[model samples]
Target: MFFSKKKNKWILAAVVIILLLVIAYTGEKRERLTFPEEIVMYLVAPAQDLFTSLGQNIQTFFASISQYREIKEENERLRQKVSRVQEEMVDMEEIRQENRRFRDMLDFKEKQEMELLAAGVVARDPTRWFDTLTLNRGYRHGVEVEMAVITHRGVVGMVSSVSANSSQVLLVTNPRLRISAMSQDSRDPVLGFVEGRTDQREHLRVKMDHMPPEAEIKPGDVIVTSNIGTIFPGGIYVGEVREVDVDMFGLVKYATIEPSVNFNRLEEVFIVTSPVQEEPRQEEHSADGEDVPEES
Candidate 1:
């Protein structure tokens, strides 16, 4: 085995020496052969083609990666642009809605004959438990305390407090609010007091008292201001009768009224600048059968 290993090493050395001698001979022959340049080019053409193909593949791989990165970056930029556009569209839509609301309020004011002061609802009480709203108009705008506030649809509230530029209104749905109202269809008026009840959740409900037991009242009867109070104007819409009750007491009947305006969704209102007068009083008959005219 040792002799065989030594023999193998000698053979490897001989092969190396032979390869070196062959290389020297080939180099000398190449210098003397003087082959045509075209022929040499032809001989090396396949090798050049193989190297070129490898280089092109490497370049194509790098180019494809760069193109992919560019596409990703562009896609990201487009997505951000689309998101910004969508947000702007939402803002524009909100502005359009607000403009429509203001226009509707202006139209309502124009249709009325009474002196109206337009005011925006600035804020709702932080404690929503109380049905009170703050308005942008106040004493500066001729919004006096106890002045009635209303929307185009119907009555909203009465002014309770005022500042130069702001005022608090007591909503009709408040438990403490009371107003004398009557049915529009019938001339006989009834006294009703508005109250906020949990059962009537979103509307101002009135428990009408002093309605004559013989009075004809229905569910669909329209209720309006009787002008019995000094605050609200006569003929101003108050509410519609929803339910009625007649107890054993033969003289009086009560009713539940659903206000014409939805207080929960109130936004803007008109304040009555001038005082509303009650119905004109008739002359009284004295005990001596003489007619007495009351001073206006």
Candidate 2:
């Protein structure tokens, strides 16, 4: 407290130098703790171990998340593959069914007695005004006017016109096409003619006219072509009887029939190319007027 300025400055400088030396000494020996500090570290060792284990668990959790993402992506790809395989299987089954149907058609063609030319339905007439269809066969393939067209199931139509390689068929639903029909049951009359109704609103309906009022055609009777038909062959199936109606005078009767052929789904048919066989005519005569009954 009594020192001069020069002595005071010397004492401040000495104090600063001593403070620097103390800081240096502490920094150097900080790593080598005293006995009490070592005892404190030993007491906290388990907590440090716990912290290390927790950090390792966090790292493992992040690694698991990355693996799970990869697995999910792989599963999605597998599902897509399964979906494609299922689609292909469905397509294959359809192809198999088509092949079986065609095979059955070939067998039916062989069993037929008449010579037939298998033809495909090329195009359907877009004009709704007429019941007509185009066939792949034409004049070049022996398809001619009035040639009966039929499939394995039943009658379809007749060739109405022809080109060099294609032909048009007048379906049974046409108002002009009429075929003489007969009933399968002997009880029903042996004579009838199938003609399209005047309404012709639907292709599924037809009328079996020229039947006697006493004829026993029933709702389930099967009608077929008669032996007298000039256009269609005898014994060819026409349709099934749906209902019967008598005339106002009860002199004649007509029946509504459902055609056996599904014209809407017609795809392939055969044209009858064989010669027509006519039934033999029978004649009877009573010569001499049978007045020979005088018996001489």
How well is each residue in 1-296 modelled by candidate 2, as lDDT tens digits? 53468888888889999999877765684658778757988999899999999989998898878788887898899899999889989988978876776786788778878888889889877664567889998899888777888877777777878999999987777656666678887664557667666674645688887788888888889988776544566677778889989879888898888998887777788888885565531121112232110000
Model 1 local distance difference test score: 0.73
Which lDDT values do the candidates have, in the order given?
0.73, 0.74
- Candidate that would win on TM-score: 2
Q: Candidate 1 versus the native: TM-score?
A: 0.63
- Per-residue lDDT tens digits of candidate 1, residues 1-296? 64379888898889999999868865674544445656887899999999999999999999989799898999999999999999999999988887787787788888777788989888887565677999999788888887888887778877878999999987777655566567787666554544445454544575555577877788888887765556677677878888888868666787788888876667778998876765653232222454322111
Instruction: Name model 1 segments beyond 4 Å from true.
Output: 1-71, 126-128, 186-195, 198-204, 247-251, 278-296
Clashes of each: 0, 0
Show pairs that collide, candidate 1: none
